[model samples]
Target: MRMKDKVCVVTGGSSGIGEAIARLFAKEGGQVAVVDVDEANGQRVVDAIRSQGSEAILVRADVADEAEASQALLGVTQHFGKVDVLVNNAGVSAVGDVAACTPTDWDRVMRVNVRGVYLMSHFAVPIMRQQGSGTIINMSSTIAVIGLQARAAYAASKGAVLALTRAMAADHSHENIRVAAILPGTVYTPFVEGYLKRHYADDMEGAVETLKRRQLNQELMTPEDVAYAALYLASDEARFALGTALIIDGGVSAAKVF
Candidate 1:
């Protein structure tokens, strides 16, 4: 029960890594707010958590929109009193080379991956500052530290995310607000699987193997693997960690294997 009585807000919690994080947090005793734009998927996640007797609420929000991000937090506060952990996990992707990417596509990624992080921290910080303690976890990718084909825009966006995490940490260190980013390598989330099936091959087996080959482990990490890392950051166990970009990419980023 590391998060006993704590209230956690996880954006994009309807599925994939975000949903996994939300479920684990609730199991560990955090009052969870599952925020996502998809009402059906969002409610499904909440219902599953409730079935386990956890206190979970679903809120719809497009975090790239400042008004919506703020309102989502307000909803969390209205129900749970205050948020102790904020996970900016909502993101969209674009597939284009560095110089060939459209400004519009790049801006869209920035709005969500970068701006959303700011919006959540901007509003949640005040609530945590008054309490003199809180945790912020921003989702990044191993691509932030390494280059990948068709990932120029994504890398840029997530790189900004890593920088934002560090900047937030420096700004709030004295205030007891811990900010960090998680860089997961090739994770087998619905997002990743779908991306592979679309781009790599029409066959599921080929798609999976193609993605796995890029990792040094020759395997893709599961959503639960990332959820465990996030759980550690959200709990009191990571009190001393700030402005750190934690990588869980199965040694892909640490080697030239990719």
Candidate 2:
């Protein structure tokens, strides 16, 4: 087992990529702390993990809130003794270019995607430093590196994530704490489904097909694909992989459409 006996905290673990990471961590023999605002879905994830005879607990809290984020970390530490890995996966997306985007939309997206990551890490880092070893994986996106239309705020937030990941890695590497980010292109998560419903309701199936063809590999990535990458970075095998942006975009970022 790659993560045998390890304790991991995954924010937004109720569903989507976060849920996939939590389940995969449990399957790999790690004790999981599933953190999210959705109490029902969070409990469902915990139940599913327990049904598989794995250890998991739900911590319902908004990751963007400093007090709640701190409490979530405290709960995990109290229950697990130490946090071996912290996955900052909770995030929200905003549509529209800068001119088209509302200030409210930008702030809301940044709150969850940027501030949430900061709060979770701010609380987790001290514990990791005291323990002398830890891994922090921030969920970034390829849109951070490439120009994606109608996602100005989202791109900005993820770009901040990538930058923050590097900063954390530089600050903590001396203490055996590794910080990294995973840049996944387009995965077919509920978030994407919701986006399609909102923006392409008239031709949902056609929109999905268009997205599939946009990928250089001609296939969409599964959440598990990103989960597997997180698993690797969180393991001892990736101890030397500090400050790395592990790209899992199925060659989308590498190709030039124009």
User: Highest lDDT: which candidate?
Assistant: 2
**Candidate 2 least-lDDT 10 residues:** 249-258
| Candidate 1 wrongly placed segments (more than 4 Å) | none
Candidate 1 lDDT, tens digit per residue, 133-220?
A: 8999999998888888887778998998998899899999899999999999888887877787677765888878777887787878
lDDT of 2 by residue, 164-243 (tens): 99999999999999999999999999999999999899999899999889888778789999999999999999978999
TM-score of each: 0.96, 0.98
Report clashes for each candidate as comma-separated counts: 0, 0
lDDT (Cα, 0-100) at 131 in candidate 1: 84
Off by over 4 Å in 2: none
> Where does candidate 1 have its weakest 10-residue lDDT segment?
193-202
Judge candidate 2 at residue 102 and give its lDDT: 99
lDDT of each: 0.90, 0.95
- Supply the TM-score for candidate 2: 0.98
